[model samples]
Target chain A: MSCFILEQAGIDAPETLADVLAAAETIRDAGIMQHPVAMVSGAGWNLAQEFVNLYLGHGGSFFEPGSAAPAINNDAGLATLEALKALTSFSNPDYLTFDSNSIQALWEAGEVALMLHWGSRGAGILSGDNAAPEIVEATVLAAAPTVEGQSRPATTLWWDGFTIAANTSDADAEASFLAMLNGITPERVAANSELAVWLGEGYQPTPASAGVIASAEGGAAPYPMTPYMGLMHTALGDNLAGFLQGTASAEETLETIEAAYVTAARAQGFLN
Target chain B: MKHRTFFWFILPSLIAMILFIALPVGSVFVQSLHVEHEQVLRTVENCGPFGCTEETVIDRAATEELRAAQPLGRFAGLSNYTDRNHLAFSELGVMWERSDSFADFTRRAMTLPFWRAMAFTLTFTFVVTPLVLLLGLAIALGVNALPRAFRGPTIFVSLLPMIVTPLIGSLILFWMVDSRGVLGAALQTLMNDPNLSLKASPTLTWIMLMVYGVWSSAPFAFIVFYAGLQTVPEEPLEAAMIDGASRWQRIRYVVIPHLMPLAVFITLMQLMDNFRVFEPIVGFQAQANATSLSYNIFNYLRGDAAQFGAAATTSMLTILGVVVLLTPVLMRTWRDFNRKGH
Candidate 1:
């Protein structure tokens, strides 16, 4: 929304977080961006919330052994929500009604210009899935989204892996079966790992995956996968709507979230 | 016949209920009291000044063996129920103690997942039920008054909303109300605002969802009331006409009295169904604005461990809540039945 806002006003891409925030004002004033559509809701709202948080540099694992708690209640969190309010203004009016598939459909249908779709899944614009050929061709594998003062984009890392069951009567057999299932064979990766950016040993990235991998190298950061992480994500996802809609202040939202996570972590035995 | 004979006659149904409903409910209650865990066994290697190293490996097999031995893990009792996911009893108490007034308490408590879901569930149930009943009753009365030739087609048209599956129906409506969809575009133009959208605003989304609940469920209500209207006695109509009662009076007193039982039946059924609202939340992706108790359970069930503990807690709470909501209706129906000597 901000990008379009800047373009319409004959301005350039923002150079700093302050500029990006200003661009939000420009768009809000222009009445060109659909702000309500941007606060997409539902089961996957957690992903959307995290996508916003990545901008303020409050993401990654909530449990890093020595860290006291999930880091969603601090300065980074408040900053993220502030930036989030600005960017979410550009989402379509039906954003809260979108799931992964619907969001993808919106992009494919050209109903939306910018969406924080998954890297592997988002690659569809560059390859298949009926994305506008012009947009697809112009698609660039860029670094993760970043905040002005932050060195890295507030992006989350993810992958799929298998854990062989050791309780099986034949551990070795189970391990071998799981290995096969995981596509340890080079041929399997060549044929089927086209959607994956990185694969295990013996598997190679597909042409599409290779490009994304090359671009993301030393760029994206892993999401903090702590025990209390789910609790925190639930807190953020559940409360974000209230804050975004202006029913709750940013401070109230953060405090409520912090209290919820602390209580959950303690109850779930994640905290002493 | 002795009571034993009556019991024997119903024994098969009793057994089936025990197996399907009773057993599952019992198991869920038990599940709510215990957390399931898969043990982790890791090994470490040590390096000494003597330059010798030994290995300790994760005993994955042992961990699985242990898990298999104690599948339910340790029993946590009511902890899961009081845990932050469901009741958040401890959290609520703490927040309450810290807060200065009811407004503050409410502000803080609304943050709890259970309270939030409860608020939506209660609001939706209360809002949708009356609206559905009213729409259904109106349609029934209108259809009943229509000429015989027109009634059939009108009835068919109304039945379409009720007959289509809820998820599919909601999706179809969702697309239409989408900002770019036909209705959405028309609405935007009609309002003379380019940014107007139904699905975007929290209030608008709730209204849309409630409208959907009525649209989809009203047909069932219409069907029931239409069938009930057939039983409205001609004697009362004749008596009312002779007494110079208005057409409105005839319906207000005579037609409604006749449909009371059916109204009770529909209200009880819808209240229960709406209280457990889940599919619309998923189909509409409206969790940002609306969530029901069943959806809360569903969210947990989709988690890594199946979140059996939390899901069961929510399920048990929902079941109890349904029982609470139905108690009066059930008693009223029973009283009516006994009075009717049925």
Candidate 2:
């Protein structure tokens, strides 16, 4: 759930994550907010991880192509996990088990005050009767991602794309299909009710895409891509969960991640 | 002449087994000997005033050429079997030398991912198989004692677990046990702890998974045991009751001996089935707590790049485990057949 606020808070935008947290805490203290904040985990934790990476000024990227080993135990990794704990301090207790859908549901049910989630899921909140009724038309998105030391909000850029089968019978037809998808007119966007696609190249952000769009405008770095990225995701998600559950200390958790990656890399024939 | 005719009649089944079972197994064994290919990359180092910098590049064309020559990459010659993820003998060796006691060594070794999966697999099979048999037998005996009119509905209701697909069944159980769901809420209130989650502890998660396994498979056992109960001759019950035997004695002496064959059948089939448990791990989101050999194979085949070699090795090992589990049962059946013929 990304923060949605009416202009009545006497603020143009939340300048940092702290601003949103402080405001939520104050409102919660005044007995105003029901659900303080809902943090998403499981696959949806990628968004939170990337946001924390930005906030912590992580000096290294795990997904860089050809990087031989993971730097998951580094200072940036530890700092990001610490920051993640703070961000989710007031979240739903079941956040460990929450996928993107459940977190989105929390926000939709009006149980959550704010959350950082995909704009697609968050868009319904700005509609009728789902959440804080007063902010139906008053919602404002933050313009940038916030970095720990940096003034701007840094985010990793991401989007889903499509491809055609190389063995298609008609190359001409496939090429035309690609062209039609790319060259959709505003009329087409309206007719199809396409929210995620480029609307005649002006790049308007839907409620679902707002967090990501803001990150892009703020010059968020591209998401990391490495040979063992799938393994890394599994390693990070599984081990980081242990730390969250307090089953293992942060150091032991990081060590577990490092060992897992090494073993996986060896299995994949990346190492001797 | 009868035997020869029977051979001709079974020729198609033999051919089917060769093609479907033997061929796939043979291929897996071969694949295990060949490692999954990695993109062959060549590195370049540029010397400069600022200390030489190195870069690695995937030589796609060269890789394709190399692949074209030996398609499955290099012949691993059992090296894949010995690799850290598979045999893990080397890691075990390292842990063994460092640890003081056998218990300490096992604890360290179980931390290895492969060994961890093995522990879950063995635990699930041994635990669930008996559970299915016991629960099944209990339900069968209870239902059998009921009036004839009620037996039909009870049997139908009992078989419901096997009716749904395993994955769907597991998902339903998972949702019901979710910390926010009804059962989870009930457990929390019962324990008087507001935040008790079944998934919080590794031991609790494993126990929950095993319980789900038994609950899901108990019906199969119940049905089999129910069918076995029908064949218990009325004469034997009359004889046992006339001998002044109690109801429990009648079951222990007469009913159980008659049900031994069906029990053996269930044991053999269930051992093989339970040994390959996979779905509940995904449903329970217990990949962090438990993993079976089948799940271990799936892990290798799951990503952007499938490590088919590791999957193949795990598959072969899984087949070996199933074979080992079956051997005693097969020998017992053979011995019983010989005694009957004599």
Candidate 3:
């Protein structure tokens, strides 16, 4: 479930994107923290995923049916970028350098009041020794906030599994599959329910899994799965920084992303 | 040495170089001229923990068959070199024709990946190389002037930057320059600006990267100059001293002349090293502000889908760039060698 991990002592948990932004200002003004939000804005798939999550929350589609061409240069994209720029405005000044590790560090250190982080990190922050006790005690996992007038959470579902190599012999493949199955047996899942938001049988919901489950129940979309999506993600990650840096306009940034994606797609033989 | 004996002695290294260097370059050139096969796409129902959705996936079996038919993929000829991701000839032409001023043209051109990397690479190489040489020479002189009792410790301390691995050294600096870090807070206080962030502004980021480059590489130049300083003949120093030359004058007259060749050696190495700056960019997370040809190659080759063709083209172009950059220094050295041979 995509949920906001908040320090309850600072502000009430937010239910919508508007609430999140509002709370961000309140947290800053109250001096609970310098920045209320910490996000991954650096170049990587993580940044692209963050953009896609917001873009999808605004009811945007990546492409039209049967088209490899990107169609994100639209109102949804502009709104997404604007929203991102706004969100980042209240974030740490060095938010551009934030990655998976740094943002978690900020959270554990109780340096930030709120974050949109993976549910998997919940256990480590809550039960792990590193996090400040004040933060751990006050931490509340709520459903992922949504864009204005949107009921669906602005997040995506991810699944981790093992796949056997195609060239492996049938006997070896069978053994590998059985071993994987045994490893994830219902007993194991029940024992490790707090570790992650597991979907299979014998999994019991915990506070750590609340955000992800709430997100799933709220109709969050899965990440886009297509042959050329990786290229588009890379293009977005590389080009979106200019707009965030205040060097380029939103429209110009979108156009550049489109051009960059087309160039990569052509090289990869996804486009003429 | 007899020609036959020379050939036999050098034959082992010749074979090794051909096998290691020449063959790899040849393979990269070939790879750069080709791109992946056009993928066969099909819509399939993907069922997982969530639910079933019709997903667009590359038809793996068909693609494998295509690959089996033609292992090297589709030959792109010179197209890969000329693509927008590479030289971007067409895009450059458009920018050139549309822009009113040189600065406008340069600004538009910097938006392209190749040119952007080139700009930073060239700037870093030019800025860091000279700075390293000067700093290195200064440090060498300063250390050399120290008393024998302190010389060993001073030399060791000066060599500390070079001893630390480049990535770790840069990472340590990266943390220190964070907005909340020691250096960063001091800078903010010094400037009386609470919002000034080294990672925020492109210009500051460039300065930071170049500073790191010079800091990390100066020791190489220093040690070389220091070693060269040891061999400076005492006779010239005495002659210059007897001529009533000042300490500065003595160094300028005798010591510098003795160290000129070492300066050339250091400059050549620094230019080559600085041109391929990669670790600091990664460590500092400065890609949004600065990137180099080596970094671009790394970007292309990493992640879920590796762009082998793009990486290969960048590699070939990087080799070409290194050669072009070293040409003047190499030419001067060749001329000097020829003159001496005569």
Candidate 4:
């Protein structure tokens, strides 16, 4: 969806590595420098790095922040790299680290050119009468792009859901639990959207709740919750923090992160 | 008759001890051991139900495979200990390798959180104790000297924080220190700087925490010292004043010594309380700069995998650190108690 919009706005949307490089050359040739890109802090960092490497590999430049990134190759950093790979390969390359609070500030200030953020953050940007319209204008979800001939855009769903613990003693609770799960009706979902607005702007319900949420106001894609989510988050956060701080090169960061994920998987009994 | 009386006297306490203290401690110890061997025990138990049954005979190979896959063992030996190798070392090798030696684990465990907590505890004790002591003493002296009509109101004012719940006090502090809070706004207004947010900078955070700590704690000290001041012999203060001593001299020479015992008591109590500073820090911002040792231990214990053995080790180390730091002051108090013999 983002690619479609960008393409309509005359921005060439690249799907593959080779195409991305060609797009980079075209942009550079047109004397239009890529502006600052926002990345979610922590696990999002690794994804950002992968994205950066893909871009840089195709002849793009990265904007280094004030602090020197740390030197990586630590076990933790390697784990982060691995976690990033396991999650998604379309890591946003040119990204800046921002927590929810920092992102809110950046969005309000219109400081960031692009942001790859949770759908809920949009509600926050829209909330409070004082919120700047420019933030709403600038914000766009990072949807997966289709290659030149592809018809549909791929959207990742980030979902937070409830599950019964294996050790839950009350077997009878399942009926009530299923009822409660089903109770998130369209009305309830719309109410939740309002509640999210009250809580903070940029808050959006999961995509599954979108049909219900769309009735109230702002809503977007809900990222899926994968088993490797936590590991990916931690790895990305640590590595990206390291990269932004200038401690690790993009390649070293990615490689080290990949190794770390392998180790973590093994430790968790997921790998042989 | 005396034996019967002694038995009656001891039995209640004995039962209470077994039911409350002893039972809980024993359970915790067992739980600690289980935590130590968690993985192996899980693996073994995953095999099948404990103690084979007739049903197991029907599918021996399947059950055996299931059991192997599950892992079942009452005792996992050092498997649990090995997973916690990170707690021992500042930097472990990048590979997923367990520590080769228990000695390394023991050494690392002793230093990281244990020593760091100790240092924080010591700083907390030192900073809060003397400040509370002096402030409390001053409030006590002032209250004691107040006219009889105003005395009650003043004492009540000093006792307000003590009467209010600590949790509530912490909440109040949280609001006050919050960037969008009233206190933050007041500070910003007074400083005439819009950008000066309390929670943003480390220095401001420390100041806010310290102020909150003193505000919530000074009252207790004030109440104790005020009571102590009431008991101070008036004759010495009168004598000092008659001897051409100024108010400062009279306080320095006469009042402080008279209040020494009470001061020592308050100091010891405050030292212990401040060393275990937990709730306030926890209630403060999630990533606030006010992390004390107790909070760190609590956070570590509350992680996804509750590392009880690690928690126990950390707890023991914290106790040791406190004892080491407080021994000298405790000894002085002991001597003072013996001398007073009350």
- lDDT sort, best first: 3, 2, 1, 4
Of the candidates shown, which would achieve the greatest TM-score relative to the real structure?
A: 3
lDDT of 2 by residue, A1-272 (tens): 23343232333345566665665665466565534666556522353354334433445466334555766677766766665666566665556566677776666555665665544554565654566664444444444336456644544444454456555679777787878786666566655442563424455556545665666566555444444566666566545665665656667667777777676666565654
TM-score for model 2?
0.85
TM-score of each: 0.83, 0.85, 0.96, 0.58
- Writing each residue's lDDT as its tens digit, candidate 3 over A1-272 gives 11233343345568898888888887777666667787776655667778988998998888778878889999999999998899889888788788878888888877777687876677877785787676777677777789988878988777687888989999999999999999889999999888888778998999877788999989988778787888888888878777888877899789888988888887787777
For candidate 2 chain A, the 10 contiguous residues with the lowest summed lDDT are A1-10
- What's the lDDT for all of these models? 0.69, 0.70, 0.86, 0.49
Off by over 4 Å in 1: A1-61, A64-71, A109-115, A161-211, A225-228, A262-269, B36-70, B97-101, B340-342
Fraction of the true interface contacts (Cα pairs closer than 8 Å across chains) found in each model: 0.37, 0.25, 0.62, 0.00
Q: What local lDDT does model 3 show for residue A172?
A: 100
lDDT per residue as tens, model 2, B186-300: 8988999866778756788889999989988999999999998989999999999999999999999999999999999999989999999999987876776677899888877
Q: Whose DockQ is greatest here?
A: 3
Compared with the real two-chain complex, what DockQ does model 4 have?
0.08
Error of 2 at A126 (Å): 3.7
**Candidate 3, after superposition: displacement of residue B338 in Å?**
1.9
Per-residue alpha-carbon lDDT of model 3 for B163-257, expressed as tens digits? Answer: 99999999999999998789999999999998899998899999999999999999999999999999999998999899999999998989998
Instruction: Quote model 3's TM-score.
Output: 0.96
Candidate 3 Cα RMSD after full superposition onto the native fold (Å): 2.2
Worst ten in a row by lDDT for model 3 chain A: A1-10
